[model samples]
Target: MVVYAISIYCSITNDDSNLLVHEYMPNGSLWDRLHTYKKAEMDWNVQYKIAMGAAKGLEYLHHGCDRPVIHQDVKSSNILLDEEMKPKIAEFGLAKIMQTNKVTNSSHVIAGTYS
Candidate 1:
């Protein structure tokens, strides 16, 4: 999917830290594009494309996969963009996958920063 970051390589370090190298995202995150850079104003078409791509990615995570993945943290900073400005969802530190045996999933602990 256009909105999902494709991991190029993954490895575990001696200290047990996981390393993941994803496809190069030249455009940076949506937050950076919207705030950090002011010279470039995204056209309506480009904005729509990013929106649709992000929606499709979320749809895939929630339904298309074998197990539903809940992205607890969803914000502008988590949406990265490639060279073509295609949005890709990133940073899954707070994500949770629904258990196969559980019909419903709930978390009492609050997670993620303020959006």
Candidate 2:
């Protein structure tokens, strides 16, 4: 499985808020393809591929990096697909880089969407 490497470029918006730009995925997101009505049925092989790819991407973020990264928002919508249906992990807005490998709960408000 290929781990999707996201490239982020920061830009200042009109209101002074920061905006991040990412590469475009022609196939859109996994959620749209799965939940929304489509002519083609998603095959088991393709499903497995996407699932494995996403898992590996998370593994890379947590263990492969110099500092462990916790992706607070991990959902189907965040997993984008390329032209060939390869899964790519997107949206790092709620991601956190930890100083240590130890996983801990936070007292601060939990981040990410409900669904």
Candidate 3:
């Protein structure tokens, strides 16, 4: 099991938007769902499945692939819901390869934010 990866060569826009991948999720972000009473009551079973799915995805990122991948940002807002309420992760502008020994300062914090 090697802990190494290559950046997928995805683009980051001048506005810092990731241009490689993303799909439409009409329900918006997970934060929006948590804020609304109608969506706050997710069943334990469903949540468990979501957790398991995300874990598997992360595990795949870390080990299942040919190289070790690091998901730089893992936040609720980056996750979107399908019509069936299944989670689909979005936003990878901040992500990078795992094997790059050189770490830069920008990796330390969010861009354009008061820190």
Candidate 4:
């Protein structure tokens, strides 16, 4: 799940207006494919692979990083598929960077999708 951040642009007139660019994923998201097509459309092996990949990504974020990053919005829709059908976690807008020595962080507000 390598992200190549090409560039960032911001409007001088509007501080709120900003844009970020990254590499494109051809296969879209796992949620889209699962919802758009029948379960039979995707073989069991492929499904298992996707699931494992997502789990590994989450594992790395939680345990592998120098500073643990909590992906606050982990869901089917946020799991993107690359051209090879490999799972890539996306959407870190709600991610929380926890202290290295702390196992958890207290938050006043709740975030992420219910579904």
Leading candidate by TM-score: 1
lDDT string, candidate 4, 1-115, tens digits: 4421111233243566644454577788888888885455679888988888888888888887789878888888888887777887877768888889776456677789855
Candidate 2, 4-115: lDDT as tens digits: 7565655557765667787778888888888877416568888888888888888899888899888889998899888878788888878888987477766476789755
Candidate 3: Cα lDDT at 105:
44
Candidate 3 error regions (>4 Å): 1-18, 100-115
Q: Pull out the clashing pairs in model 3.
A: 4-68
Off by over 4 Å in 1: 1-8, 105-107
- Per-candidate TM-scores read 0.81, 0.80, 0.61, 0.77
- Backbone Cα, N, C clashes tallied per candidate: 0, 0, 1, 0
What is the per-residue lDDT of model 1 for residues 42-111, given as tens digits with 9 covering 90 to 100? 8888888888878887887888778888888888888888878888888887898986567756568788
- Measured by lDDT, the strongest candidate is 2
* Model 3: per-residue Cα lDDT at residue 8: 37
Better of 2 and 4 by TM-score: 2
Q: Give model 2's clash tally.
A: 0
Q: Ten consecutive residues with minimal summed lDDT in candidate 3?
A: 1-10
Superposition TM-score, candidate 2 onto the true structure: 0.80
Q: Candidate 1: deviation at residue 19, Å?
A: 2.4
